[model samples]
Target: MKKIDRNNLKTFKDFLIVEGEKVNIVFSTAKYDRSFNRNNDEGLKNIESLKVDFNVNEVVYLHQIHSDNVFVFNNNAKEFIEREGDAIVTNKENVIIGAFTADCVPVVLVDEVEGVIAAIHSGWKGTFNSITKKSIEKMIQEYGTRIENIKVYIGPHIRQCCYEVSEELKERFLDKTKIDENELFNGRNLSMERCILEDLRSLKIEEDNIYTINLCTYCEEEIKLFSYRKSVGTYGRLFTFAYKK
Candidate 1:
């Protein structure tokens, strides 16, 4: 459990050392762009950083669609082409799982014993579709991963402190939630992020299995993150990933 502040953004690193496995979950701050076709400058730098500790060639990244589609890389890409998916899981060692986000929640999951990891991009659409549950189900069904042993690291995104939405949107969120939403926000809450976590909880995930990084990309947009809502335009994306070798 460690937080790294770089380029004015909060990058999370979850190191896993067990059974001869060296796995890590790394997240990018909003300062990086999400729409990279190849390994952009920031992406290259991030990959290089990870390579210093892992295999750079084994890293995999997705072309993040807001939808719930997930893709598992076989390390068969020509250069670094982005795909149209929101999640990726792999049991292969040295294969990295990467996702992009600016204000959206970028989630990373790891099953220590099985040595399987997933990198996810959980946007409003993804959360509404329950991408966490989908990813967990995929792990269990496709990779023989035990849900109880899953450790989910929720990376930095727009926090509730500044995640204010209209009353109508809030009500729509509340309508979908079974838990009391009254105390979720001090004065506001990030409905999308909260929803994703609840979705995982509903899937029988333990409370301790979930970890959240309380960094707000919107407010800290100029500091170290790239915020779509704050940026007011389409631009680069952050490089958030989970790599194991």
Candidate 2:
């Protein structure tokens, strides 16, 4: 993924592009807080402006309760706003589907062959419940997308270097996912990236097809993104969206 000159949104330049298909993965910085939970009017207006700026037909997002729910959006469905879910999958063109996050893992999946895309927000709760796995399953079940055709992009989030969790939560994640303790946990710190990658691998997604931004929301040196864990009082959200047209 490459950051545009504006720096507010980052787009994938050479990944997931196919003949007659325009696929874009957008990653928002701290400047664009597209969270509708507070002051919905401004947020909705910003979304409208984003559609014009990004050249997308529509923007769809969810309320993001940190659950494993994946909302499938077809072309015939109504405009989506503040629907309760943690992920979104769509096969329609020019429609941007996304998930909001502040330090939580933001993942964008695309299958150029099938013209399918998904955006997922997998926090500690969502990861434990296998949200990414469920999102891919939804795409396969609904759109007949092949697991091998999908390309996964794991965006910026709070890394294990600064993400310290309690013993109870750590143990639960280990026991539930059966992920290697050494790979996922460094003493008491947990790697949300590892959990997400492991889940994708279990579904036979090739490692070469996966690209990780590797920018830590808590400690990125170049750009400072929003982080709920490191914020003093108020924190903005980073929007991660995928578009296929």
The best candidate by TM-score is 2
Structure candidate 2, residue pairs in collision: none
TM of each candidate vs. truth: 0.78, 0.87
Model 1: lowest-lDDT 10 consecutive positions: 11-20
Q: Which stretches of candidate 2 lie over 4 Å from their true place?
A: 1-21, 31-40, 75-79
Clash statistics: count for each candidate: 15, 0
lDDT of 2 at 226: 80
Local distance difference test, per candidate? 0.68, 0.78
RMSD of 2: 4.2
**Where is model 1 more than 4 Å wrong at Cα?**
1-21, 30-53, 79-82, 184-189, 221-223
- Look at candidate 1 and tell me the lDDT of residue 59: 61
* Residue 19, model 1: Cα distance from true site in angstroms: 14
